[model samples]
Target: MEILLWIIIIGLFITSFVALFFPVLPSVFAIWGGFIIYHFFLNSGELTTFFWISMVTLTAVLLLADVFTGSLAVKQFGGSKLGGRVAAISVIIGAFVYPPFGILALPFIAVIIVEYWQQEDFLSALRAAIGTLIGFLSGRLAEGIIQLIMIGWFFLIIWS
Candidate 1:
C-alpha cells in the first residue's frame, strides 16, 4: 500500500516534469499535489495535521507562482501582451502535438511569428521571441528547483 502510493507520487513527479515543457500546464502545483499525496499517504505517519497544512501552504504558493511567473517574465523581458498571448496559445497547442521539446518550442515559435506580424520590425520581433524564450526557460528552471526540493523531502520522509 505504501509502495503503491509512492508509485503514484513518482508518476505525478514525472507528469509535472512533462508539464514543465508545456506552456499551458502548471508544473509546480501538479508536483506539489503529488507531494501532498505522498506525505498524506505514504510517509505521513507521524504528523498528519501538520502535513496537510503544509501541503495546502505549498499548493497556494506554487499556484501563485504558476499564474504570475510567465506574465511577469514577459513584461520584465520586454515582450508585448499580444505576443505573450500568442506564446501562451502555442504552448497549449504544443502539448497536444508532442512532448517535452515540442511543448517547449511552441512559445518560441508563436512569439516570433505573431510579434513579427504585429510589429513589422524584424529586430523587435526577435527581441520579443527572445524574451519569451528566456521567460519560459527561467520558469522551467524554477519548476525544476521545486521538483528537486520535493524529491528531497520525499526521500527524507520515506527513508528517514
Candidate 2:
C-alpha cells in the first residue's frame, strides 16, 4: 500500500510536468493532488501550514504568469485582443489536433490567420504570429519552472 501510494504521488508530479505542454491537463491541480495525497494518505498532517500557504501563493503566481506572458507578448508584437484570444483557443485545440507539435504549430498558424484577417497585412500578421509563438513558449517555460519548484519544495519539506 505504501509503495502504491508513492507511485500515485510520483505519477501526479510527472503529469504536472507533462501538462506544461499539453494545455488539456490541469497542471496546478495535478501538483496539488500529489501534495494532497501525501498529506492525507501517507503522512497525515506532515505538511506544515506554511507549506500549504506557500503552495497556494505559488499557484496563483503560476497562473498569472501564464496569462500575462501570452497576452503581453501578443500585444507587444501589435497583435490585437482577438489575436490573443484566438491564440489561446488554438492552444487548447492544438492539444487534441496533432499533439506536441500541434501545440506549437496551431497557435502560430491561428495567430497569423486571425491577425492577418483583422489587420489585412501579411507582414504584420506574421509578426503577431511570431509573437504568439514566443509568448506561448515563454509561458510554458515559466510554468515548467514553477512546477519544478513546487515539486522540489514538497520533497524538501517531506524528506527533511
Candidate 3:
C-alpha cells in the first residue's frame, strides 16, 4: 500500500511537469494532489503549516504569471487587447491540435491573424505575433522553474 501510494504521488508530480507543455493539465493542482495524498494517506502530520502556506503562495504566483505574462507581452509589442485574448485562447487550443509544435505555432498564427484583421497592418500584426511567441515561451520557462522549486521544496520537507 505504501509503495502504491508513493507511485501515485510521484506520478502526479511528473504530470505536473508535463502540464508545463500541455496547458490543459492543471500543473499546480497536480503538484498539490501529490502533497495532499502524502498528507492524508501517508502521514497526516508530516506537512507543517509553513509548508502549506508556502505552497499556497507559490500557487498564487503561478496563477498570476499565467494570466499576465502573455497579455503583457502582447501589449508591450503594441498589440490590441483583443490580440492578447486571442493569443491566450489559441495557446489552449494549440495544445490539443498538434501538441508541442501546435503550442508554439498556433498562438503566433492566431495573434497575427487577429491583429491583422483588427488593425489591417501586416507589420504590426507580425510584431504582435512575435511577442506572443516570446511571451508564451517566457511564461513556460517561468512555470517550469517555479514548479521545479515547488517540487524541490516538497522533497526537502519530506526527506529532511
**By TM-score, who's the top model here?**
2
Which candidate, 1 or 2, would have the higher TM-score against the true structure?
2
lDDT (C-alpha, whole model) for all candidates: 0.70, 0.92, 0.92
- For model 1, the superposed segments whose C-alpha errors exceed 4 Å read 22-44
In candidate 2, where is summed lDDT lowest over 10 consecutive residues? 37-46
**Tens-digit lDDT track of model 2 for 1-160:** 9999999999999999888878899899999999999989899877999999999999999999999899899999999999999999999999999998898899999999999999899999999999999899999999999999999999988888
Among residues 3 or more apart in sequence or in different chains, the pairs in candidate 3 whose N, CA or C atoms overlap within 3 Å are none
Q: After superposition, how far is residue 72 of candidate 2 from its true place, in Å?
A: 0.7
Q: What is the lDDT of residue 30 in candidate 1?
A: 66
Instruction: Provide TM-scores for the models.
Output: 0.77, 0.98, 0.97
TM-score-based ranking: 2, 3, 1
- lDDT string, candidate 3, 50-109, tens digits: 989999999999989978989999999989999999999998999999997888899899
Candidate 1, residues 22-69, lDDT tens digits: the string is 645656666766767865675557435665576566656655665567
Give the residue spans of candidate 3 off by over 4 A.
Answer: none
Lowest summed lDDT window (length 10), candidate 1: 43-52
Report how far residue 152 has shifted in candidate 2, in Å.
0.4
Which residue pairs does candidate 2 place in steric collision? Answer: none
Candidate 3 is scored at a TM of 0.97
